[model samples]
Target: MKTHERMPELLAPAGSREKLVTAIHYGADAVYLGGANWSLRAKAGNFDRAGLRDAVTYAHQHGVKVYVTVNIFAHNRDLNGLESYLLFLRDAGADALIVADPGILLLCKETVPDMPLHLSTQANVTNKASVRFWQAQGVSRINLARELGLEELRTIRQAAPGIGLEVFVHGALCISYSGRCLLSSYMTGRNANQGDCAHPCRYSYSLLEEKRPGQYFPVEEDERGTYIFNSRDLCLLFRLPELAAAGIDSVKIEGRMKSVGYVGAAVRLYRAALDYVKERREAGAAWEEIVLPPAFADEIAKVGTRGQTENFFSSAPSSLAMLYDRMREIQPCTPVGIVRGSNPLLLETRNVLEAGDQLEYLGRRLEPETCTVRAMSAADGVPLQRANPGSLILLTVDPPLADGAEVNALFRKQHDRQAE
Candidate 1:
């Protein structure tokens, strides 16, 4: 195998402390999170001041970097404690700040001049000129607009080879231009730019003519209303070699509002893909000739999705990118429990777990293992036929967990398969 200096960083989202831990254990090189204020994911389990401090500490102990989002488009009233918050983040040992608004950028430069800054994707940086402009402004890294294609990214990287570039490699896509949309604010009174979006784009809609009161017409023939603006989720697992050859510095997974299972599964799969690409590259394989294992996509399908699309990665997206028939693809598997302890085999149930049922355990560095629920009881040893969501139960398995299954490992059960 040939040698390269570094692999692209696998950046993951951490909506809360548990999610942060899961991302780290699943092999993320860095984690991005939102503080209690100034983050776009106001609905996520953001951290408080004390929590922010502790989160940074914990991530650093695990050799992971933490970038706090202060990327809201601000108003005059929103600037109330802005300076103090900037100082607090700097003092809290945050690695960098992700900012979108120019006012906040200037404030971060003035208030915490020594701290590093990363331009957020919400800034809509689509061209090489925009990349150079931000680079000149003391920005260390820029997450380019998601709408760019692979060739465009290569062009930008060639234009400015000094600065770092990042792109979203997985998760949801927005219909609007670079996630700046007024539909949420106009319809739901929540400003997306200010970080309180209600996701009106995902809502179902039908046409209502002025003359025909109480009459609704479907945009499509389905009984359920049409989803005109719903875009498919992005999955670029197979394109890692191309991205690495393009000199992209980081590949990010985008789900601050998603579940811990989603975070763990995504980070683990992507980590394996990136490593696979690196090894193939080192072995003198051309980027175009590298093919990822098919199981990567099959395993990722276990997590819920609206169907996958390349979205503008290779060329302009077609109408096929929209999910007109349904809101989400039927998930192939459901998370059933989380391993809380291994000594007595304590399991925290996320879904119903019953005796004689088969379960698949998602471990840290190995392929998922299948096991059977031989017996289970309450935490105090009383027998139970089944365990409901949120219950902690002691379990015995037909095939005991392998050597390294630790706390927080996730377990899932496959849904009954149907003929296509």
Candidate 2:
């Protein structure tokens, strides 16, 4: 792969401090995030002044690159304060700034001329001339719009030989044109232009004619109506060969307001996949067995993903599950007791117990689950609390459970956001 003259980068999103670390540790070649202002995900937990500095330092320590977002459509009022923000980004250690507004791009180049300017996908860069224009204006990269077909990108690459091209390989998609819709403002007076989108497109709607006041018609699916105006999530994990051969520079994932688990799982999977292709080129063959395993990505799917679909790369994907709700939280069962000694496992139970209740620890690693509780014993040498929710339970594990490991005799209600 080294001789293949290709070093495709696996770029991931890092919305929080912990997420950035997770990306680097799990394996992201680079990361992108939004700062306080001028970012598409203004509602996301963007970095404060101190966090950006820390994030840059941590990523570089692990040899990962960082890109900050300056990509929101800016207003005249927004234009006045960007210089200080640019200076802060420059000194705080940003490798590049992804910009959508032409004026913002120009200002970024003029102010932080040393930093690499990446044209945002919002620029709708579908032609060679625009690519060349941005390149001349000092853009080191162009995040091509998702609306373009792969062949269109090939033509753009051939025409603008000098400009580097980046495209989103995975994550959410909008029903609008290249993700630049004004429907939110038109519907709810929430300005998407100023970044307070109401996401009216995601809502299910019914149409009614003026002649028929009470009669309504379903838009797409008649049953309960559909996820109309809802597009599927994009995934290109299996299409690595085509993407690598496409002559693009970086393959980016689009999720900034997502969780750390999501960032780690998806980034690790793609990072492994990217390395798989890289290794194939280096070793001159595919091991097939050694390439990225679906099991890895599956573990991430358990962390609440929209499920994977290969959206519109080679062909359109089937329907995707809706994005996970960040607010609908998953709470852990409170730890009540810990294993104290090694007899029939001398243990202290939080709640009252009989004798035999299936013991469980917060086992996370290994098969069948190490923390998964199965066996049980009693501190009094009598075991019988076989079925219970809260009890000072002593459950024996296949492999002796850790002494300090948390034991659960209680079951808490778990709900999937969409399922609920």
Candidate 3:
């Protein structure tokens, strides 16, 4: 049994202020988010200057670190306010900056010399030499490329033990190398490098003969047209023990544009898994002997995904990594509402909620409690049979909520069929 010196930090994504709160509530050690500009997720509900400052303070108050993303590949036009933004982030007390472009890295070094820098995986850091080079440039951490296998990761960790090593333990797997794709630019005039990706890789393709201009043929891989470039979502919940043993410093969940439910669920599940591993290790359990409970993976499947894949973790991935049939898996559970107020037990509906529905409230520490909806009413106390999205409804459950069910605790209900 290989013993790690310390437990790896469980990092989660925060696309918005709400998501940030959710991540922290679910026990993330750190969260990575983007600002209004210069972020790879430009379409996300990113923070402005004021919002960034507030987010930093709020996260710090809760004892969680905040890393801001300035990770877009910059063009001449994109460099206008780069220096000012970097300075602003530094002043806002950001724990670190995640950067991908070499020019951005150089500018950060010059502008915010005291600020910690983390090299983004978009930099395609696959080898130990790249890690060493980045470390030489004052990078405190480096998120390794997603294309590397577990053996390659072990070798890289062995070569560069000084710098903090992080990897995407879960989330959508990009078809291109570390998310540097040109397909969006070529197809929709949106450059992925500049962060306005249209996700052309997820678009289905069909065969069209040049000679027969109007003839369209199905490019079928399995009856669902050819989705050649759509890769499955990555899930490493079962592999946490191995990653910790291999000297990985952080495990990241990759979804800044995902919903609050996704953020909370992923963070909660990973937090529990890491804790389980830590407890076992403290009891002198062998790494090979430690096995995570099946509920961890089962809970993760409730969140939306293209499909689950290990990606390039164990070895070179095959065609099985690509979701050739569908864009995303049919989620087994849908996030129905969020606990808005604990006093009256108010819930702000995210999806439709009916009177007779049963919901599973995701409790802190991953101990979910199920309750049957006995009755529903509007905020104004109007009786209702069904509550639509965005409605603030009052719910009466058979088994009442336990004491200390925190506000913003997510609630979900199972679908009619199982998620594939």
Candidate 4:
């Protein structure tokens, strides 16, 4: 099938149960998460056995698919409970298991013979041979390494037309070659492959001359210290046409460790973009002639990032791919609270929200209504000028909204002024 003829899945990351729900509400066709033990994102509130079951149930109920992460590179001791975990995932009704290690693949085949398998990017399936190799091993999908260019992806797709091809369309760019770096383990004794990465690559590095004791030199000519290895976050919203044409089956977002607000905003933006692309494609529009919505240009900025780059997608990456300073977030808005109830609009505050503040309700349908924080007070009905983070607050809504909506405070990053 032609790439535009088939709509690719929008796979979002969900680190926790709440995030999973948020992703689904924001229009994620599928969500990828890790179980507590086998996930690479050890710090990301990964689902326990019960949590995994609940998450799967919730996602499936919403008609969204869930893929469990079992991609950790296992050692001898790690394989002890591997079978049991696979069984748990099978019982949990996960749509697939993201696997990297060859041992894990065999174990999944033996233990949960019916479960689908997706080869993680850690496998670095760059060429058609690797794709075919994984396909022989029963991997239903192969997440192409982040380093692959459009031409490379097209080649792989042409070579292995039957297998599902997934690629990271957005999120943080790894400094390593498909996340095979040893810098984290070598620096902090936290193995990246084992799910305990300390992210030492984002740290600034200084040259230490062996001959000149105690003398440290900056790696880059930046007075504010250079983060030589810290890469800019990937943003390929404009390149969706290229990716869809490259025969990618799924467009994956790369932040399982990100916040709930970020998940919702990012997923919604991508969802809208994909819908637009599909519409244009159906209208017989050429890839170069398709125009994205103007609002989407700045919409992604609401999700905090360390800057943005196209990475290796456009061409060979140079210094343009690296961020020589600290990871800067270009956030123009902040999450105010989450709606617990609609009547009187009870909210669990994530940031200070004042009366008359403009609040955007993030929900499954992407409601266009921007609510004003009229007559705000504590949940107990105590009048308040503003509700701080962690407070259970209430806001008067003109037209009452549905229950379980997420609220975000609107502001501009430059002026720090309230968004009118």
List CA RMSD, all candidates.
1.9, 7.7, 2.0, 3.3
Q: What is the C-alpha lDDT of each candidate?
A: 0.89, 0.68, 0.89, 0.82
lDDT of 3: 0.89
- Per-residue alpha-carbon lDDT of candidate 1 for residues 127-162, written as tens digits (9 for 90 to 100): 999999999898999999999999999999999999
Backbone clash numbers for all candidates listed: 1, 17, 0, 0
TM-score of candidate 1 on Cα atoms, chains taken together: 0.96
Full-model lDDT, candidate 4: 0.82
Error of 2 at 47 (Å): 1.2
Backbone collision tally, model 3: 0
Model 3 worst lDDT window (10 residues)? 411-420
Q: Per-residue lDDT of 1-420 in model 3, one digit per residue for the tens?
A: 244389899899999999999999889999999998899998989998899999999999999999999999998888998999998999899999999999999999999999999999999999999889999999999999999888998999999988999999999888899999999999999988877899988888888999999887878846667787899899888999999888899999999989988888888899999999999988989888899987876777776578788988887889988888878778788889888898878999998899889889899656689999999999999999999999999888879878745788899898757333
Measured on C-alpha atoms, candidate 2 has an lDDT of: 0.68
Q: How accurate locally is residue 397 in candidate 2, as Cα lDDT from 0 to 100?
A: 49
Give the least accurate 10-residue stretch of model 4, judged by summed lDDT. Answer: 407-416
- Model 2 misplaced stretches (Cα beyond 4 Å): 2-4, 211-217, 220-223, 286-309, 315-419
For each candidate in turn, the TM-score is 0.96, 0.74, 0.96, 0.91
Looking at model 1, report the run of 10 residues with the lowest lDDT sum: 411-420
